[model samples]
Every structure is written in structure tokens, then in C-alpha cells.
Target: MKISRVTARGFMSFDRIDLELNEGVTVVTGPNAAGKSNLGRIIDVARLTVASHAGSQRGNRLDVYERAPRHGTRRFRLAVGIELDQPWEQELIATFVRAAYASSAVELPRPAHSPNVSAERRDMDARRRLAPESVAVLLRGFLVIHYDEGARPRWRASWHHSSTGDLYEAVEPVWIMNLRNGGPLMRVKQEPSAPALSLADAWRRVFPDDQIDARTPMPEQLDFMGILKRLEHPISLRTGAHQDNLPLLDSVRDLYMLLGWDMEDARRGQVDFVHVLDVVLQRACVLTDNRRLPLARTFPLEAVGGEADLEDGSQIPCELYRLKNGPLPLRQRYQRIQARFTELVGTGFDVQATPDPERPGNLLIDVTVPEGDHEYPIAFSGAGRQEALFLSTLLGGDPGRVIVLDEPGVHIEPTLQRRLIQAPDSTTQCLVITHSADLVPVTAPGDLARIVRLAPSHDGSQAHRIGHLDPKDQTRWLQTLGPRDVRALLFSAGAVLCEGSTEVSALGTWWEGSSNPPSGANISLIDVGGDKSFGRYIEFLKAFSIPWVAIADGPALRPASDLHQQMKKQGILTATEPDSAEPDFDAWKAFWAAHNVFSLANVFGNDGTAAGEFEAYLKRLNLELLSQVDKGRSKPRIGAAFASQHPMPKEIADLYALIRDRLQPARLQDAQGEQA
Candidate 1:
């Protein structure tokens, strides 16, 4: 059961946030202090919380009061609304432990200095989207959230939680995963103990008949980590303590009893316990949890041998580290060994437990890393590698489970982080909360990929995503931006870059109809941030094959002063319509203003009107008109008489009209006829 949405109120950074999750892979991104990690932590808390007053109504017991919202006349109605595709809509809520008011959390340098405080804090809004069935399983059934507030500079984290909800059952055969406790490792008050498997309960009993695939090599059979997890069950037959090194046969027999395996079948050589185990394990596939925690792949060979290719398209060179192992053909091996193991086990191969011959070492048959080597063990790599390996072993065993990864890139290289995102898994869905741009989809001019941006808010944290982007302003912004930072986020604010923030802030102001005197218009606008390092960002967007746009100002030209030409040379801006002017250096200020629909004052001659002191200089450009109002500062009243005489407000209003006249393509509209 994947989580369709995550809501946080009175949680770290999140006052009230609603984020829609994607089914397969949802990448969460933002700059350093944008609260990416905190946002991830909220998800961790939502899925793992126990009944409490802290985060969700089901928040962790210890931090319950700490994360609960402040008591209000209305209780502040802290809740995260989710729409699960598989299970059905179920109200998932958690109570906040504490809450801080906007006025209290933010110290206004000058209370009256700023006249545009939004009713919604920067991070206290909602980002909505529909939930896919695939993602539902991952969130509710199997989840891996990896966050590292653990180590400074670099964090390593992995987390997941599961509770039987209607969402889990819709996806059959694939059972929900158990709670994953890899977090801050906080020790909280223990409540009632979870119930052990009841041997007497017939319904609880697994297959009465057991059969082990005896022909399978010991190494190959026991090679997969998933093979061991099934063994993590309670033994119902035997009452004695589990052995430290019990004989394989005896242990299987004992577990058989505990699980309520038929005793008659065991004596008759029809080992029902082994049969059940084989049925559960055979042909089933597991996926690596490469998000928060990666996996490891190793070969004992020390010498460097040249290339080796196995009937597949991939080429593998022999080395101590084969970063790419390529996919292993499981079917071929299974077919080859089925007969041999069948003969060896005789009648009841399910009886299990076969001793190895010749070599004293345990027979871990055909245990080899697949061509797709996603794991990195620490002994060879580092502590982070070890952590990744452990996490992979724990979370990668099931494709049906949901995985939540908080800062999954901790200790991971940027390129590898990208690869982790690239790994293939059809059934498993991934929710990755990461600070690494490398892991984000490599966005182009117009790509859409699930991305969520979170930031601290006046009251709490807020989120923004693709679906929430306003159409009117957003369309124009995309024309300028090329859709780079705009992501198909589960829940997030559109991506924010140093310069991009300026536009988003402007858009936010304009969209809310509060551009000081108010733009007196509604526009869809979003920002596609870029920096010296857009390569990584671009790679992320492209990798996910997402559509988006990235907008940034071009560098100023000094000699030629050809702003357009210079920007084109820098690859910052590409003009569909080439400028005849080679180069003319405009001050950064001038160019920025121009992009914002403001014409330099010198561009228009004054028709001779008393210029507001602030716009006095601007009169030189538009003597009779103000190209663009300086937001709240400039008085836009003179147009009353100008527009009265003309069909439209000549200089300024005409331009505004021209922009408004732009007709968008039909596909851009939402189902409701609004811009999507």
C-alpha cells in the first residue's frame, strides 16, 4: 500500500502540508536549507508514528507531545489527506505535538516594512495529486525512508512502516512488509507486545504441507537475502529454544511444528514444511531498495581478468569491482538445477536440510551478483557502503513493498545516486527524499517527473508540485524557463533557484492578487532555478524522462553590449528569434528588469507628466507612460485619462493587453477547462 498523500501539521518545517505521491519513483528535491530533509522526516514520522500527540494522530509515542499541534479552540484540524488508488480513500491522520505561530516563529525585521505577507507561509500550503496503485503498495505495504541527520555533512538513512489498511489488500499476493525501524534509533516507551503467530489458529497456519527445492544448490538456494526473510517466522511445532547451529533438517522440522505443518507428512517423507517454503520462495522476485539504502555485489576473484559477456547486450569486464553486473538469468539456472535437486531430494525435497560434500565450507551454490550491481558493501567502500548494504538486504527483498528513503544519497556518489534511481523494478514503487541533484530526473525544456519541494513556512512548511502550478503565469514562465525546474512533484513548491526564487515570489505575489497595488491580473507563473551547476540538475530531469523548463537570466555583454547575443553564447538563453545585434552590455539590473516586462525609462521619451519621484528617472524611457510599474512603489493612476481616450491603455496597458491576448494551445487546459 503506497501512500497517496502525506500531511504534516505542527511537524518540523511543516505547519500543514499535503503531498501526493507517485507510484513508481517519486523524487523529492530542494536546496540545502529548503527543508528537503525535514520534509522527508515528516513522511518517516507519518508512516511510523504510534498513537500520540506529536506528528500524525498515530505519531511516535515518545515524541507525541513534542510534535502535536498546540491546543486550539478547533484543535487546528491537523491532518494529511490521502487518496490511495489500490486500497481506497482512508482518512490517515496524526495529531501534532506542538505548533508555533507565524508571528512567533518569524521575527520581522520591520513589521510594517513588508506589506506583502501571504496568508500562506512559504512552506505551509498544499500540493495535490492523484495516487497510483503501484505507489500505494510501496507507501502502505513496503516503504523505505532513508534520512541522515545522523552524520554531519553526510547522512545515511532508511525507513518504512506498515499497518493493515484497505489500501494494502487491493494488490494481491504481495503482502505488506513489517515496520522498518532504521531511523534516529530513539528508544521510546514500549506499549503492548505484538502478538506472536498462533499455532492453534487454523487460519493463521501456513500450508500444512512443506517441500524444499532440494536440487537447488545450497549457495544458490540460500544465496538470496529474500530467501532468509521467509525464515524469520515463529516456529510453532517445537517448544525448545532455536539453536545457534542446529542441524538444517532438525531446524526445519522444528519450524514445521511451530508453523503447524502436518506431522504425518513429515514421517512419510512428504516434508510439507519444505514444500511450503519452496512454494513461497521459488519463482518469486525481490527488488533492491537502492534509494535510501543501496545494495552490494561482490565476486571473490582477486586477479584482474579482461572482459566477459554473457549472452546479453551488456559487456562485463573482469575486475575487483564490477559496478555493472548486468542482469542474471535466473530462469536458466533454475531449469538446469531443478532435475538434479529433484533426484537428490528423492520424494520429499521439501523436507529440506542437505549437507554439502567435498568442500567443508557451506555450499552457497551459484551465489553471484546480477549484472545489475546496485549494492556497495563498506569493507570495500566505506561505512556508508556498509549501511547501504544492510539497508538493501532489509528492504530489497520484496518488489510489492513500499520503500521510503530519506536522503538515500547519504555517502553515495552523485553518479551512483543517479544510477540508484535508474535501477529497474516493475512492482516496487520508490519515494526518495534526497538533497542530491544527481538523483533528480535530468530535466529538459519541458519534461514532467514527480518531484516535491519543501520549505519552512511562516506558520509551518509548505509543498508545491507540477499539478499545482498556475496556468496563466506558468505558461509565460515556461516560455522563458524551458521547464527545467518545474517538476512533476508528489508534493512540493516548484523548484527554486537563486534567481528563480525571485520569479516564483513575484508570481506568488501576483497570483494571489497582492502585487502591492496588485497586478490587477491573474497569471500562471513558476520558476526554474539554475546555478553554476545545472548539469547535475539537468541530468536528473532527463534521466526520469520528465518534461519541464528552466529559466535563468543570461550574462551581461560588456563590449558589444548585445545582451541577447551574449546570453546565447553562454547557453543561458536560446532565442527562437535571433537578434541582429551582436553584443551590447546591459547592466544586470537592466536585463533583469527587461525580462520582467519593464522597459528602461530611457526607452520612451517623456510626454511631460509629473513623474513620481521613484519613477522620475523612468520618464525618460516612457515620457507618456510607465513601461512597467515598480510593483508597489509606482503609482499607476495616470492611465485613467489615457485609457479613457484610447481603446486601451496606450503604452503600458497596450503591452499588458498584448501579453494577455496570447492564446495557449488547447492541450494545456485541465479537464475543468482551467490551465493544468
Candidate 2:
């Protein structure tokens, strides 16, 4: 099973959020408190809720009421859309229907055959013919949990199905199951009723004479436990009774057990909803739980020998021990983990779990550095190394799991951070909540849509999936953004996009020299290569709701310039050329400035002079400082030297102040208050 969508309302930092998830890696990124981590928390809470309902032993539970957003609705809802793989869906349908037939709750039309035919053959034939019909009864499935201020949290499992047409297009409600406070599973009524009715009465009303229609509307209220008791009967050993037996039902129960469901409960008609959800979450969702810390320095020997799946980094030492000493397949997995760690650190090392001599039944983890031929306890290694090792194990594991990592790049370096994302196999769907820009470049250009950026708003947090860009534009976007530029723009409160390196250098120098720099205010200065590329960056930043202002050279405002032509091509500009000989440069500059694109000529009131160009303006303002730089030095180098040696020109300083004020209003107000 794979998750296609996640929706949350009035939950924690989310007032309402509907996110479409891709099949492969989906990166969630934003500045602090933008609800990136809250997204992970949503999944974690769902996982825990499922676990509580499915198992007798309850784990630590998150109070849903406490998680409600302040000043928002007291009630909240979370839902996930699930899509089952064809093979698994077929197996589930075949087994479930077969079980229903065996229990005598449903009867199938008899197959035309001779009396000499074996009973097993008849049952198999019936299942083969009925599987397609049953598939249509569960066309689309989703799990939803709702919490009210004064009531117990409730879970509702609903499926959209249809009796006719293709199952894929089915939209009619087939069945709905509601479970509250671990009580009996009840069917949701199609119409309102005064009170609950017994399962026998509701079943009789819905399906008389033990006849069943898989596509029939669910009754107003029916208890699954009562139905299970009514269906229970002793199986006869005679050949006549043997013909009615459905062996596939046994396989269905086993499948549930394999997925960590309680077998006894399954036989009693209780589905382990948590284990069913795990078919999508894959037990890897725990990696995103902030409460689960990394692997401890040492663990008991018995703890390291268990067969339970690794739920978090704390179990890594145990998992490593099992992999090292287990069978061939496991040993191979261990080697892969070792290779991954080596790749991250650029050094070969061996991981081993040695028995602690002083502490009975305890094990200590140590790393062997091949170059020095010495062993060191893993606890003594740098925090980055420990985190990298933990992450490498997660990436190297079997594929097909949904691995939701929350800031896996926290201690990892940039180069290894790229490798960390790349290491997950294609089948392992990764939802990474991160602040690392290094991960952006490694993502396939076509899959840029997988990047979901969040920003704060009046309601709460909003998410924007940067959908696919044109092929040419995608290439240009990546080319213009280096690591620093990407980090600056992606994580900043506001950004300034300029036409060339000179503006960036000059503005950066001025920013650094100020008592309160733009950096201190979380404002980013980005050189978007040239004015022609500003449109693309502006669109990209807008998608993430990042505030931005652009600085363009004087020539860009001319109708015949490349930037103007590009904007026209992109359909951002559509005005016809003027009939007059002289183009209105001042009017064009003013027009663009209103849209947050400031031209040097208009901003500095030098529209008709050489100072219209930023480079020319810098030379005119501080010729002596510009001359101090080497003649062969780049324009950016000269701009930097000029800003460092002299006070910023009045026009540039005024523009900088305006940008700071716009991006950091609260800070500006505080500074003003201090002066008063």
C-alpha cells in the first residue's frame, strides 16, 4: 500500500492542510516554525493511534486535545488516502470473500460441474470468478480519525466503490466502519437514526436470507463482533461439509499475522487497523518522531539479539548486531551499511558489537579504522559520524518502506547529505523534512515537483508543491543557484534578486558593515545571473511564498532588451510597442518598480546618464576606491572593494534601508522604540 494524500484540519500548527504525496522521495522544507516538523508529527500521531487500536499493549499516546492549535477549533481530523498494489489487493479480495462464504454469511452461485469433481477445485473456481466483482466493492480506501473536545477519538475507514463501470473510477460509498475507544466495530448508517441497533437485526434488515451483495450500502449500525459470533460453527469432517470449506481464508489470517496483527483478534473479526496502516507506513515513520533519540552507546546483549524490526536509531546497535551475525541475506545488508558509512566519511571502517567485560550481558559498539588498524568505541566518535552511521543503515535497508526522516541532515555535511538522499533505493518512498540545500541539487530535475515548501500565514501553515517547470527553465533554475544562493533564498525571511555578481558583492559588503545587517534580519541577497533570469527566480520564490525584491540594470527596461523579450516570451508582458520614436524609460522603470522590480536608473534618479547602470554608478560614486583594485580584477571584486573602503552611496543606502524595513518590520519598530 502507498499513501497518495494526507489531510489535516485544526491540528497543531495546521489550520487546514491537504498535501498530495508522490510515490517516491518527497522533500518537505521551510524556515523554522513553518509547520515542516508538524507534518511529520501528523504521521507519527496516526501511527501511534493505529498501534493503540491494534495491540493490547498501548504505547505512549499523544493527547489529541492538547495538540489542537491555539485559538483554533477544538475538534480536529486527520485522514490518509491509501492505494493498494494490484497483487496485494487481489489477494485481500480473494481471501476476504472466501472467508465470508465459509462463514455462511454469504452464498455464491454454484459452479456447473460433475459430482465427481473435487471440493477444493470447486472452491478455487468460485474464488477465481468472484475476485473481480469483490475488487469493485473496494475501489478506493481511506482512513480517517476525528477528535472532539468532549468525546473519545474515533476512527472511520471508508471505501468508495461502485456496482457498475470500471473500479478505478468508482466514487459511490460501498462501506464505512467506525471504531471508537476500542469498542466493537460498527458500520456507519447511510441515514440518521435515533439509537444503535443489534448486529442481527441490522444484518437481517440489510441482507435477508444470508444473501450478500458486496456492493450493498452498509447498514446504519451493525456490530462486527456479533456477526463473528453468529457465523461461528463446527466444521464437519465428512466430504459433503469439506466441499464448503475455504482454505484461502486461512491464508488471509496468516497474512494479517505476518503484518503484526493479532491472530486471535483476526479470527474474531477484528482487523488490526494499525498493522493495516503499516502496509503503507512500513514501521519507518518512527524515524521522524523527535522523542526517539539516536542509538545509545551500549545496550544489553539480549536487547541486541531480538528479531523485532528496527523502529528508530536507538535500535540500530541491536540491528547491526543481528545483521553481522545472522544469515547470508542479513550479513549482506550489514556490508551494504558499512559501505554506505564509508562513502559518507570517505574512510573505510568496520562496525562490531563486542561483549562488555565489566558489565554482564551487555554489549559495546566499536568502530575499526582500517588505516590506523585501531578500534575505538563508537561513543567516542564525533556526533556527525554517529548520525551518518545511523542514517546510512536506514537508507541501506530493504526497499518498499515509507521512510519519513525529520532533519536527517542535522549533523551531516553537505557532500554526505547529498549522498544520504541519493542512497535510498527507488522503491523506498522518502518524505524528508529538512533545512539542507544540498539535497536540492541531487533531486532529479523532472521530480522537482516532489519538493513541498511550507510558509506561515494568517490561518496557519500553507504548503506549495513546486510543480514541474519547463525543461529549459528547470535547467536555468539549477544553473543560477549555487549552494549558498539556494540556502539563502530557501530559508530566508525575504530575498533580494539582482542582475549580476557586482550588485550581490556591493550589497553584501554594505549589509555586513551595517550595525544590523540584512543577514541578521534573515534577508537573502541573490545574484540571479542576469536580468533575463529574474522572472524564473521570482516565480520560483513566489511559489514558496517568499517575499522578494529585484534589482535590474537600466538596459533591461528598454523594449528591445533581452530581459524584455524573455518576459514577453514568458507571457508576463503583453503590451504592444509604442508608436513614438523615443521609448518612455522613466515610465517603464516606474511600472516595473511598482511590481517590486527596481531599476538602478529610476531608483537613483539617473535615468538619462551613465549612472543608470549599477557598475557605472559604483565607479562614479567611488572612483578612488575602484582604482585601488587591480585593473584585471572582476567587476564584483571592484564593487566589494569600493563598498568596504567608502560609505554606501545615498541611493544604495536608501534602497537597502527600504528592503530591511519591508522584511523586518518588527525589528525596525523595536530599534525605533529604543532610539525614542
Candidate 3:
């Protein structure tokens, strides 16, 4: 199953977040403490919660009240919009539903004219009618897990029948059922006094005219206890009931039991829907986090006869043993893992599981790096190599599983980080939580739509996806800013978009000496290559709600320059240029300054000099010092050295003060009030 959307309220860092996810690899990124990890936690919780209901050993470990957002609602709700694969859909209808019908406890109404038709044939007919087409109708829905302050957690699984091919637009609840902790199963009724609808009723509501077997049991008459009891011995039930009956119900009961739910609870109410939901979740989703690598690194080795065993038998480290001695599928999985590792690390990198030299028969995983001539134990490898190994094991093993990776790029180098982002195949859906600038570049051009940027807000944290922007705007953003610039702007609390490297270097040098440096305040000094692109960069920053200020050369801000036209086109400059084709320095400066664009000309020209650029302004301040710098050095490098020794220019100092004040308005306002 692939999740198309996630909605959460009063959960973790979110008071309310409705995030629509894209297929393939979606990178979730933002500033520190902006709830990037919390987004992953939410998805992981949903995965675990679904697993819990299906009877997986992985159950929800978090307390609901503790996870609720501060000063927010005590109750929390988390829901996922799921689209099932063909196989899972078939299992729900043909396997689970068909078995429900074949139970001896469920009595179906017989057709008046078809008295000779056997019950077995009628069950087969019912399943055949519900296959492919009905599967599509039933598979598009949501699985919700929610809790109230004074109540235990409850689960509601509902499906929508779509006539217009839009799942989100689907208004009718075709199948509505609820599962409560240690309580009886409840089918949601349209009215309080009315009887709750069953899956069969849902089908009839959607396809009213279609003829169905009268043998199909109603919700109230269906014997859930008898069905679950028979599920314990699926083989016997298959022979006595329908020949096509699969052991799906047995797996469901096992999952339910694994979740600590008693078999006797099946007697309380109908749980046939739980059987259907379990198969969808258990078989289709896998959530993983970066914490796996550390565990694998510290896993203790124990000698078990002639084989290697981890003391705790952790699945992650034990995967190495499985690679060496498990079944053929696992060995084949190892080959895929090795291939992926080599692809990301380099052509010469190789991973192998061989006998440990110290422990005669015990197997140990070893790696051969391109730089090293001899192989070394994996434990001795660098963290980057180890992370690559762990990630490779995850991505290469299964193509069908939906993989959720939390901060996988933390230890990998920039180049490998880019490769890792592109590693997942087209068929595998991956949700990656990352703050790495290295991973941002790979999503450009085609996959820009896959970026979901989160930021802290008044309520809690909010998510914004590039896909939500107009297609033309997304394309323009790609053309305007480089990945590094995009990363700087997206992750910073505030950004200074400078025209050239000199302004970036000089301001950065000056800011470093200040009591409140840019880094300390989470501010970014981004060189936008040239002032012509400043308007585009500003627009992109504004789109994502990132605060920004621009610094431009005096010439760039002149009425006759190309930047004036670009800024005008972007609506950043609304004033009409002077009738004469000459620089209106004062008028243009004030016009752009109102939009937070500072000009070097105004700063230096106050001394009545014709200084129109940053280099010229620096020259005016200390010509001898600027000349004494190494001629081989780049302009920015010399600029940095020059700014480090001299006092900051008054205009630049004021701009710096403005940025600091804007970032902390209340402090600035209080100081102003004291002066007043």
C-alpha cells in the first residue's frame, strides 16, 4: 500500500497538519526544530498503529497524552490515505471476504428459484463478483487512529466508492467500521437508532443494481467467534468450507494475538473487517530510521555453536547472518545490497560476509574500500561506510515495501548523499526526512515537486510542498536559484541575498565580529551570482515564507540597468523609470529601499564620491590595504580580508542591525521604548 496523504492533529509537534505525499522518493527538509523529524515520527506512529491492530509485534510505544502538542487539544488524531496494490486488494476481497461468507455460522438468503445451488458455489460466485472492479472501489480510503483525553485509543477504517475517479472528492462513506481497545467491534451507523452497515451493505450501496448471492451474511448475523476459531485451523476450514480459502484469516488472528488482543474478544462483535485491514498494512509498509546504524555498530557478537549470533538477535545486524546462511532469497538480497553499496560508494567497493578469524566458524561482515588494498571488518569501517551498508540492505531487499527513511544522509558524504537520494527504484515508494543541502540538488528539474518543506508556525509546525506551487513558478524557481542557495534560504531563519561574492564575503566577515553573528541567529548570506536574479530569488524566498533582504550594487539599482527591468517585472519595483535614460540615484534608491533592497552607492555617495559598487566603496575606505592584498586571490577572498580589519561601513552596519532587529522585534521595540 502507498500513502497519498497524512493528516494529524495534536500529535507531536503538529497541532494540525494535512500533508499530501508524492510517490517515489519525497525529501522532507527544513530548519532545525522545525518538526522534520516529528513528521517522520508521525508516519512511523501511523505505521506502528496499523501494525498493532493487524497483530504485528511492533506496537505503538508512545503515550497519546505525552505526544500531544503543548497547549493544544488533549485528544489526538492521525490518519493516512492509502491506495492498495493489486495483490493486497485481491487478498481483501477474494481471500478474506470470501472466507467470511463460507463460514457455517453465516446464513445467507437463498434465491427462490435456485434452491439446488450449493452454498459452496454461491460463495465462489460472491468472490468472483467482488474481484478486480470491486477491489478498486474498496481500496481507496483511510485508516484513522485517534484518542480522547478520558478514553482509550480507537481505530476507524473506512473506504469510499469513487464514481468520478477522485478519492479526495469522494463524499460517501461506503464502508465505515470502528475498533476500540478491548471493546466490541462497531460498524458506524448513518443514524444513532439505525442498524450499522456491513461490508456487504457497503457493496450493495455502491452497486445497487448488481445481483449478489443471498448467501452473503449480514453484519449482525455473522459469527465472528466461529470464523476466528476456524481461522486457527485454516487448512481444515479450507477443506470444509471453500476450496479457494487462503490462510489469510489465520495470519490476521496471529497478528491480533501478537498485539495482546485475546482470541475471545472475537466473540464480542464482528472483526471480519480487521482481518481485511491487517493484510493490507502488514504486507505493504516498512518504516526505518537512522538509529539502525548505531544499533548495528554496537551489536554484540555471541558464539552460537559454529554460527555467529547477536546477543539480542536484533534484526538489523542479524541481516548479515541471513545473507550468509538464510534462504536463497536472502542470499540474492545480499547481492542487491552489495550492488547498491558499490553504486553509491564507488565501483571498487565490495561487501562480504566471511568467517571471523578470531571465532573459527562465526561469520563476520567485511568491506573492501577502493582506497584500501586489504579487506577490513565492517565494524572497523567509517560511519559513512556503515550507513551506506545499512541503507543498502534496506533499499535493495524489497521492491514492493513502502520505505520511510529518517535522516539517512546524516553520515554520508555530499556526493554519496546525492546518489542515495536517487537510489530507490521507481516501484519503491520512499519518504525521507533530511536537513542535508547535498540531497536538495538531486530533486531539481524533474523531482522538484517531491520536496516538502516544514516550518514552525503559531499553531505548531506547517508543511509546504513545491508541488502545490504553479507548475510555471516551480520551473522558474529551478532556473533562478542553485541548490546551495535554495538550501541556505530554506533552512535559515533569515537570509541576505547579495548581488556578488564580494558583498557576501564582506558582510559575512563583518557579521562574524559582531556580538550576534549571522550563524548564531540562523541567518544566511547567499550570493545570488548577480543582482539581475535578486528579484527571482526574493520571489522564491517569499513563496516559502522565508524572511529575506537584498543588497545590490549602485549601478544595478540605476533606472537604466537590466536589474531595474527584472525587478519591475517581479513587481518588486512599482515605480516607473525616469523619462530620461539616466540614473535616478535618489529616486531609485528610495524605491528599492522600501522593499528592503540596499544600495552601496547611497552608502558611499553620502561622502559625495561617485562610488557605485562594493569594491569601489571598499577602495574609498582603505585603498592601500585593498591594494596590498594578494593579486592571485579572488575578489571575495580579498574582500573578506579587507572587511575583517576595517570598521563596517555605516550603511552596511545599519542593514545588519535591521536584520537583527527584524528577527527579534519585541527586543528591538523594548529598547526603542526605553530610549523614547
Candidate 4:
């Protein structure tokens, strides 16, 4: 199962947010403090709720609400939707009241003395006494296995009082209901009571005939904490004598512990119980930026030489061994992981966790790469290679789990960063929190990858999933751009979409020296290539709701027919074309004024000299470097020269005035919005 959405109210930095997620890979990005990390932590909270249980106290994972909500509110609600490979949507909800402490004791029901008292009656009595919210921890799901090995597997639905209207079946046709008590087992013959009736109503519409039978066993109540501690054992078995002490129907591991596991010395086995048990819980794995391998344990070894002995006269194995004595398959798995890691880091680079040569019995990892026709340790290599090797170690394990990566690309290059997330064997569903544009794909229509952009909204972060980019816009952006360029465009408050590189260069140079550069006002300069690209990018910007203005050559020099058509279609332009060397500025200005835009005609005055674009205007100004333009002087050099010219041209000064005046108000509004 994978998370499809997360809805939170009063959770860190989110006043109220409903974040939708896509299957497989979803990249969540935004400006810092827009709650990208908070969203990832929310996932962490959900994973902890499902994976770990409170041992001696109530679960503290939901303690995110310890502080008041955003804007000094009380209480918090979190809902997570998990998809089970079908249209089926399973939801987990956690609600916290300010006064409730994690240490608050929840009493377990005492065993009935009289056999006349029905187990169902005792179970209901216990459930009614517990808080509805505390029971949500048990409402995740149940792994139902038939005691009879040959029976076909199925899930039955029933409803009882639950925080999120959850129902989990322990076995076919035998649903577990009313999880408020440690292990309430009662048949749902009539309508479910109170809070659960709402869930029952929804369930009936989908599966009307679904019913809970009494075939499932009823056990004496166990404290939520006690149940957690008891299941820490490698194998928990319910035998013929323990039918009355069943486990809570929250996780597969708990279910097996409730039933029976007679495996011989399972605790000593290489595979962990949690790994096997997590099959039903839909395990989630998290890879954070600070990920590190745990400290290795050493074992006593026979001394190869007198130098191998420690001061205490004891020798320990020097080999940095991982699963060396485990099953052959386990050893092979690590080898494959090493191979894959080598492939990702680059050819001729490999990591070896072997015995330390000089310090016998001490484990050491040698990062080797071919240098000067000989292998050398990568510790002598650059930091980038070392970082990549470290990250690769984490990926050498299992695939097909829910992987959450926090800024996985922070220390890597653009190419490797892309490859990090796009690993071929990444069957795992990944929720990546990142600010790197290289990691954010301008995904095509119907692609599995999604971009979830978080922007500040009223003291909280608003999440917008960019489902698709206009094919034309994407094509134009990709024509001559990389991730960094696209990221700058995505993050900028507003933009100046101009004709070509010359205009971009000129604007950039001028903006740099000018106190009020477009960047200062959170505006960016995007060269949309030529006339056709300009039109496409404009449409793209509009589609993405990005505020933008166009700076282009006059109609005489480069008539943007596509842009003209678009303007007409949007009812922004109504005037007919004028048959002249220059455009009819009066009519065009009136139409373009409402939309933040201008052309060369609006900025510069034409002196009947045939000089039209930037380079032509530069030559008209009598710049000497224009003579060696092809050989050495380039657009940037020309732009730098234009910016340094004393007594700026009247048209150039006018352009700056227009940009300053227009972007100031936009910057103010943007600032206000961010503060909100």
C-alpha cells in the first residue's frame, strides 16, 4: 500500500492542508519553510503510527499537536489515505485535544469471573470506557490468515466506533470490530454504534452484503502498551490453551502474535520479525539527509600476529563484515547491492568493507577507484564521490518499500541527483522532499511522476500538484535550459519573458548594477528563444498562473503572429494591424497595458535609421567592440558595454522606469502573501 494523500489541520506550519499524492514517485518542492520538511515529517508520523507501537505509554507520534496550531489554534487532525492496489482507500486519522497527555493511563478490562457473562458484553463494556482517539492506533488494518492452510484468503468489512471509521478483518468473514479496548471481539449484527455508524453507511454503499461473524475469537483485554512490549519477542504464538488471549487487529505482526508461530529458535534467524510482519502493515522506509550506518559490533578473533592483540591481550575480527555468517542469499543480496552502488557512483569506482590491513581485527571500508593505472582508496578522492558512496550504501538493501528521502540531492551533482531518484530498480514508492530543480521533472502528460509545489498561503503552506505542463511550454522550456534555469523560473515571483539571449543578457547586466533589479523584486529573466518560443512560453506562464510580461522586438523586426493570435483570442487585443515600418504604438499600448508587457516600440524611439534589435542599437550608439563581435565580443560583452554607457538612452531609462514601477507593487503583494 502507498499513501495517495495526507490531510492535516493544526499540524506544524499547516493551518489546514490537504496534500494529494501520486503513486510510485512524487517530488514535493517549494521555497524553504513552505513546510516541505514538515510534510515529510507528517509521513514519518504516519509511518511510526503504523510501524511502531507505544510500549509503556500511549503513542507519542501524535504529539505534533503539543504546541498550539498555526495562528495559535487548539487541537490538530491528521488523515492519511493508503491505497491497496485497487479503488480501495484505507484512511488513518489521528485527532489530539490539547489537555490529553501521552502518559494518561487507559485501563484494561478485568477478566469476568462468571462464565454466564458473554465475552461480547465484556468487550463492549471495555471499549465504551476508552477514549475514541486512543483507539485510532489500532484502526490501521489487520492481516487475516486462515488457520486452515488451504482456505482461500479474503477480507471482510465491519464497522464499530473508530477514530477514522476503520474496520480490519482477522480472517475471511471474521471481522475485528470495536478496537477501543486492547482486543474487542464482537459480532456486528445490527447497525454499528455512534462514530462508526457513519463509516458503516459509506461501507454499505460499496459492499452492502459485508457482515461480521462470530467466528473470530475473543480475548481478555490487554493494555495497548502491554501488547506492544509483548510482541517485541521474535515469535509470539497463540496455542490451543491461549485462544482467549488474541492480539489486536492493527498489524500483521500483531495478528500473528495473536494467532500462533511455532518456528524453532526464530529469534536467532537472520530475518527480523518486523520485516516479515510488515507485509500486512505496508512498511515505510525513510532515508533522511543525516542517514548513517549504525556502529558495527566486533567479535573476538584468533590473533594472526602479536601486533593483532589488543592491550588487554584479546583479538577481534578486523573485517568490516555485514551478514558474512548469515544465509548465502543474504550474502548475495549485499553483493548485488554493492554492484548496483558501484554502477550508480560511476565506472571503475567500488566500495569494499574489508578487514583493516595495518590494524588487524579492526573493520575498515575501502572506497577504491582506478588511479594512475592502479587502484587507490577513494578517501583520497573528492567529497562528491565520498558522499555518493555513502548514499549508495543505503540503497543496497530492499526495494519495493515506501521510501521517503529528505534532500537526497543536497550533496550530489545534477546528473547523479537525477539518477539517485530514477534508479532502475526503484520499484519502491518514493516521497522525495527537495528544492533541487534537477530532481523536479517537468513531467509530460500521463506520467507517473508528480510535482507537488508548496507555496505560503495564509500562515500555512498550500500544496499544488502540477499534474501536467503544456507540451508546447515544456518543449520551449527544454529547448535550451537545464534544471537550475527551470527552478529559477518556477521559484521566481514574476518574470520577464523576452525574445532572445541578447535581451536576457542586457536585462541581467542592467539589473545587476541597478539597485532595483527584477531579482530584488523576486522577478526572473527568461529568454524564451525566438518569436515562436516567446508565444509558447507566454501561454505556458499563463497556464501555470505565473505573472509575466513580454519584451520583444518590434513588429517590423520580428512579428509574433502566434502571440498576436493569442492576444486576440484572449480579447486583450482588438485593433487591426497597421501597414507601416513601425507598429501602431497607441492602440497596442492600450491593449498591452492591462497585461504586464511591452515591445521595442514601447521602450525605444525609432530615428528613421534602419537599426532594429539590441546589437543594431548598440552599433548605432558607436560602440567600437562591435567590429570584433564574431571573433571575441559576445552578447554578454555587448550587454555589459550597454549597461556601462554614460547618460543612458532615453528609451533605456524609460524601460527601467516601467519595470521598477510595475514590479514594485507585485513585490509588495508577494511579500504580503508570504507573510500571511
lDDT of 2: 0.60
Evaluate model 1: give its TM-score: 0.34
List model 4 lDDT by residue over 102-131, tens digit each. Answer: 101112122345223233332333333223
Give one clash count per candidate, in the order shown.
Answer: 143, 1, 2, 3
TM-score ranking of the models: 3, 2, 4, 1
lDDT of 2 by residue, 135-191 (tens): 433324555666666564444322322223222332443344442222222233334
- lDDT tens digits by residue: candidate 3, 253-344: 43344433465564343434454555556555666654542433222255312222221223445565556465797678777887898898
Shift in Å, residue 275, candidate 3: 4.3
Quote model 3's TM-score: 0.77
lDDT of 1 by residue, 64-127 (tens): 3233332221122222222222221111100000001111112223244334432123112100
| Model 1 spans > 4 angstroms off | 51-61, 64-377, 383-391, 443-447, 468-676
Return whichever of 1 and 2 wins on TM-score.
Answer: 2
Against the true structure, what is each candidate's TM-score? 0.34, 0.76, 0.77, 0.61
**Weakest 10 consecutive residues of candidate 1 by summed lDDT:** 92-101
Whole-model lDDT values for every prediction: 0.33, 0.60, 0.60, 0.47
2 against 3, candidate with superior TM-score: 3
